[model samples]
Target: MSDTSALPRPLLEPPAPQPNPGASGPWTGLRTFATAPFRARAWKEFAYLIIVFVLGCLATAYLFVMVGGSLYLSVLVIGVPVLAAVILGGRVWGRIYRVLGTVLLNAELPEPPPFTFRPGPIGWLRSAFTDRTSWRALLFLLLEAALGMVVGYLVLMVVALTALVTVSPVLWAWKDPHNVDARGVSHHSMVQFGDYYIETWPRVLAFAAIGVLGCFLLPWLFRGVCFLHRVLAAWLLTPTRRDRALTELRESRRAAVDDATATLRRLERDLHDGTQARLVGIAMALGRAEERIATGGDAEELIAQARTSSKEALTELRELVRGIHPPALDLGLGPALETLAARCAIPVELRVLLPVRPSPAIEAIAYFSVAELLTNVVKHAAANRIWVAVLPTGSDALAVSVRDNGQGGALQPADASGEAVVAGGLSGLAQRARGVDGSLFVDSPVGGPTVVTLVLPLAGPQ
Candidate 1:
């Protein structure tokens, strides 16, 4: 009989999107460390540390055994120098470990103390000895060495035990070896099973199974030791708060520089297109008017030339002013983009979905990006159809995209090509789009179709 109540029921609505906690900073580091490749690389480093530690311990033990109590005298003579060397070595090792850990674990490590101008190598060595981090790393190394020794002994013991157990039946059957009884007695005979002796195949199979089980557990035991190594590494390799802050500051500065360069290029392009071009046109018109009067042409002809030149100058001046700041943008990006799309040579489809207008700066960048993208499409793309989409991206930004169905292959060359060329008209547009803290990316193949996307920060209505 079917039980309707026992069956699971579907929800009426889809579940809301869960927030990603590890997408930002430090948590991201931890998440990266947990991935398979990073974990494997960390284990490789741990293995190398174990090897170095074992060698160091062996050397130390050899020196101690040879000198005995006189080792104290040797320490008094060489102890200071050895300690200094170990500390210096630790500093160097710590720096290398820091770089490796950052790459593998994506976590920052404590910054090494600033270097000072020391008189000689000895002075520099003394400074390294005084550094607290150097001492800590040395202590860590020593602990690792001790732990490695213990683990090595345990591994040997397990191997020996497994070997002995696996061979016990053979030893008893072939050599007739004496064995310990439950009572305080030694016997040279083997126990008999039903139809066979205990030292037979059945007993041998039992011992082999136990040995195989122990062998299988060996990797788990090694993993536990490796986990301890990870703990030590995490403690000694994580960066100090100050270093992390400095790193963030450097990244921010780089982003700002890129933004500034983009802005400068946009300003340069506007000056060239607006003020410079207008001045040039005015100069040409005035030259023609002067030539007409100087040639002793009729008064009506000269007057007519003057009037045409004056009208052209006025038009150029208005265009120059518009280039500096377009009034279309004040109407909002939707209307501005609509006006742009209407002017495109190719058919354009624009999609805009936003409840509120973005900031003026964001709008300007978006508008210019779309304008440049359409210009490229009309000039070189040979596109029959174009699509532009604008939408609010989450709560913090606006997204804009232009797509075209044309012969693609629009990538900028390494030296100079396509829209990225310095002399290319679209270069100014690309620069304008990059200004005002926006990113531009193009995906175009050789056959057909191209898509350009831009993302800009959105503050609020101007």
Candidate 2:
């Protein structure tokens, strides 16, 4: 049986219509070709194609010279360093191609795993020889060079031909003897089609119209070629799916262990410094009061001290309990978040719209994720306003977002080893979220708004 009891009332209302980019009307193709040459996207892609073309040529030339010479000299021991250099160069170039493809082609390729080298020249040689990634990169460089030369030449010819034909009326020199007949009268050859000579002025105008049409079609055609190049790059540049999955699993396990350790240490410190210390003070006060009473000396002051110590201890214990699980959560996630917003250092606009209650474990994770994000904003982001929202991402997951309008340059930068530097408190929060199979994303550029989002499965920590 299916459960519908938890569904929200808002689900009954119709959702607003969203425009589908892929859905096309009768004039869609016409409109695309008409606007292709003028759109910024087309220009950006053209620029990207140009860059790929240039880099491909350079990579091919360099690798052919260096790698070929090294292979030829392999009998000599000196060739070892040269071979290592080729492999190293290929790896670096592969990374550059990956970055470019990501930005230009919008291809989301998983990063190749980091290479580990042992001590000494022999180790370096062995690693270089065994590195499949570097060799694949070298192969890609060779392929890209051939592909780029052909595609680049074709694109250049198309553009140049289009420009010449389109501007023939303005730029064609009729006074030149070659353009004129033996009679020395005005004459020029027009671009030809099959069985058609566009030699007359009227035909030349028609040829210009054809050129205009070609200009519009070329950009879209180039885009198709670029997509094919992206496919080739993905196959050659990224690690295999199995390898990527293993890497992610290892990282997740490490993060889970680290997060648990940090949490336990924090709890222990809080207990030792706050509640435990207060309890010890209370015990000493009570002991002193008992001594005063038994000795028949002034006991009033000692008794009063005991009462004060007890109150302080009780306060510390309440605070400690709250740290473990906020008391506000007893009322449910929405109300708890509202209570949290009320205590924020900066003004927070909170919104929560969930169709059903998430599992308690998921709820706890969501709560702490929000709390940590808000704390980060208060500490690092000098902001005047914050907005926190919790809503269902789908039937299976909920998304919580905390956004602040502050100076935003808060990101976990990658180290030299290409791993994200996870030493900061914010990185710890991300790891904690990851422990539950939830994901955290931070989008904070310099000088402004920072938005952090955490998404958790509705079924809880899976």
Candidate 3:
């Protein structure tokens, strides 16, 4: 790929406009309020709220009875199975709630952990005793049942209030006009506020206007309530911080180990096919040359051919050694990185401000890391400038940064494909760094300028 380092850096573009599903414009606030009660979404949410409230009340009572009974009956052998059944039942309901939340509330709840079966009776008991997932699910079920009733009721009330106010004028008009009090005035109004009544046309209009105002505020109010519920569900439903961290660590460790194994296999294959093959050819050529000399034939031609094979073998050996560990790294990281910079497709401004040198392994890692990062910039980032820096981190580490003025946007996104598209380019680098107790951080916003920083401990991999 061509490195357009001579080209000038482009101006950063403004952020693209995001699509908004709600109302817009100067009068959007009033328009939303006036039309809130009529919106299909509002009605749908109200219907969902009603369903949840009734179901939650039933569920709350049932779970409370079942769980309470189970705890009381724990002294009996039947209690153990009963409690286990309740927990397992809770997980089933938890999954159902997750689906409901996704459809009704648009909350993307994470998948709960899988239930693992154990082999013997003792093993089964142990599994049940240590089932964190089941316990969490039961807890969420209890919380959802108890809180769902209150939150769902509040949501319904908000919708009902808006609907009532919206139809106040028509409701008052339909009231029995002949009904009157001792003052000869109608006791009922379109809508009643304590003793006050909205009976007159002007008053009805004003009350309807207030209803319209309520309608506009409904969406936001509804969202606020839903947001609280979503947060609660997320906290109670998703994996905890420790679980997530451990998961990440396990993945990284697996990646690193797999990468190392792959690399070793690749190296073995390369040697067998390249350097070793060339050495075998050279040996055969020399043997022929020796045979020619003894037989008093034209040995000069054979010797020359053998010499060419030997040179080729040497070249292959050098390339293989370089792949294993760059010879430039023996001098130090600074010179090694400079050699890498010199070979980059783009103009890389190299800076090394290391007061101390790290171990050989650390130097090799720094070298290859810079090499790969620069390669990415040259190939992927259509940039005009690149800066590479390697600096010592005080007493016990090394920091390497690669910055480019490119059309950035290389950060990983939430991809449901579970494919390694994001992990393809920089993930290997990250895994390699992790192998040495190091980290790789990328800051590439969707415009220009991409910065990738790698940090390693001086003591090297533990």
274-356 in candidate 1: lDDT tens per residue?
65665666566567767866897545654565566567657766665565556799899999999998988888998987777
Ranked by lDDT, the better of candidates 1 and 2 is 2
Error of 3 at 30 (Å): 5.2
Which structure among the candidates has the greatest TM-score?
3
Judged by lDDT against the true structure, how good is candidate 1? Answer: 0.61
Q: Report the lDDT tens digits of candidate 2 across residue range 202-233.
A: 87777788888888888887788788778888
Clashing pairs in 2: none
Better of 2 and 3 by TM-score: 3
Better of 2 and 3 by lDDT: 2
- Using lDDT as the measure, name the better of candidate 1 and candidate 3: 3
Error of 2 at 49 (Å): 3.4
Q: Candidate 2: which stretches are off by over 4 Å?
A: 1-32, 98-116, 119-123, 126-133, 167-198, 238-265, 286-430, 436-462
Which candidate leads the pack in lDDT? Answer: 2
Model 3 regions more than 4 Å off: 1-48, 116-119, 175-199, 282-314, 355-362, 382-384, 391-399, 406-423, 431-447, 455-462
| Candidate 2 similarity to native, TM-score | 0.58
Query: In candidate 3, what are the lDDT values of residues 1-462, reduced to their tens digit?
Result: 112222222212223456786646788877766777678766555555666678688778768798889877888988987877777676777776677677778788887566776998777777776778778777776677766798777767877888888887787788644345557776656455666766678988898888787877877676666676677678777777877665667776898778778889988998898878877877887888888778888878767876887888788778878988999988888889889888888888988878777888888888888888888887778997899877766678877878899987765343776442234767788777777777777766677677777888887965
